[model samples]
Target: MFWFLLIAMVVVIAAVTLAVVGGGESDVLPEAAPQHLTDPLPLTRPVARADIEELRLPVAARGYRMGDVDDVLGRLGAELAERDARIAHLEAALAGAQATAADRPGAPGMFDEPPADRPGDLPDGSGERGEDR
Candidate 1:
């Protein structure tokens, strides 16, 4: 009886292995994704929030397809790099402009200061009407 059970288990394992490995009777293998052959990301422009929100990735046996995720990540990395470079450039330009403005102290700034001719006016920002202590 034990020998029979052992033989039965072996046969079941063999059958499963053959089914998984594709026995000599079949040469074709299942494709990972045959329907969605192309990626959904747009090639002409940088990816937007709407694009990511609308994007759908293919699913594999384990999880989302590796290639599809890789492509999306690569595109996002590129977009971030471009934005970072642009930010750095603008910051540098702003710094230069601020430095140039600093060279002149008497120049009136964008905000208006309190009038010195006003009654009880003081250089300090306090609007006090009390005695000057």
Candidate 2:
């Protein structure tokens, strides 16, 4: 049985070697003379100036008037004033919060207390008390 398998493997390898060496099938195209081709129609035409000048423009009228530069500048100044007021309000709020935090007890020295030895050091009775009894 082993010898039969070895012979079958040798036959398969020989067939594969023959197929590779023989360059299995032809994929090359036959040689032919190249042909020249030409375009069938004209690609472009010249535009008439009268046709262009007589064309009616279809633009919609703007709702807001953009007439004077000073008017635009005035609107921008009003918007900036509103933004400045908002910034001032936020700064006041931040200052109030900082003041309140500073006035609160244990604000600066929050971590000044010594670290507890175990989790149950503070008196809520979960069995890690230091006193013997």
Candidate 3:
């Protein structure tokens, strides 16, 4: 029984070795991502918000010129945040306007123009005092 087990183990090892050796050249091996792939900035590519946020610059003898990179990243982050806030504000305004229009009794439809006759008209084309101009 011991001899049989030893023979089986040897056969398994031989099979594994043969399979690995028979596999085609290094080309068949899984290729690793290039070193630069992890860096946020790649030459000739446009930088994005996430790329700026997650950037990892290489350091040399004097180390990285971090002040410049930090300033740029901070400015970019702030700008991106401000733009997001503006988008949210606009979206909220749009939603509120839509809701107000929907609640009106006679809201104007697409291509419908407000009455130019009214001095100060509401969105529903009602005059300021709900009377005809």
Question: Against the true structure, whose lDDT is highest?
Answer: 1
Residue 57 lDDT, candidate 1, scale 0-100: 85
lDDT, residue 84, candidate 3: 91
Error of 1 at 51 (Å): 0.7
Better of 2 and 3 by TM-score: 3
Which stretches of candidate 3 lie above 4 Å from their native place?
Answer: 1-63, 109-133
Q: What pairs collide in candidate 1?
A: none
Model 3 Cα lDDT, one tens digit per residue, 34-102: 332245453464457676668776554476657556765776677678789999999998888877777
Evaluated at residue 23, the lDDT of candidate 2 is 64
TM-score of each: 0.55, 0.31, 0.36
lDDT of 1 by residue, 1-133 (tens): 9999999999999999988886674576566554342558788987889988888887777888787889889989999999999999999988877777667697753343745665346567575645655
Question: How would you order the candidates by TM-score, starting with the best?
Answer: 1, 3, 2
Using TM-score as the measure, the top candidate is 1
Error of 3 at 1 (Å): 61
Model 3 has an lDDT value of 0.67
RMSD per prediction, one decimal? 6.4, 28.3, 13.5
Candidates 1 and 3, the one with greater TM-score = 1
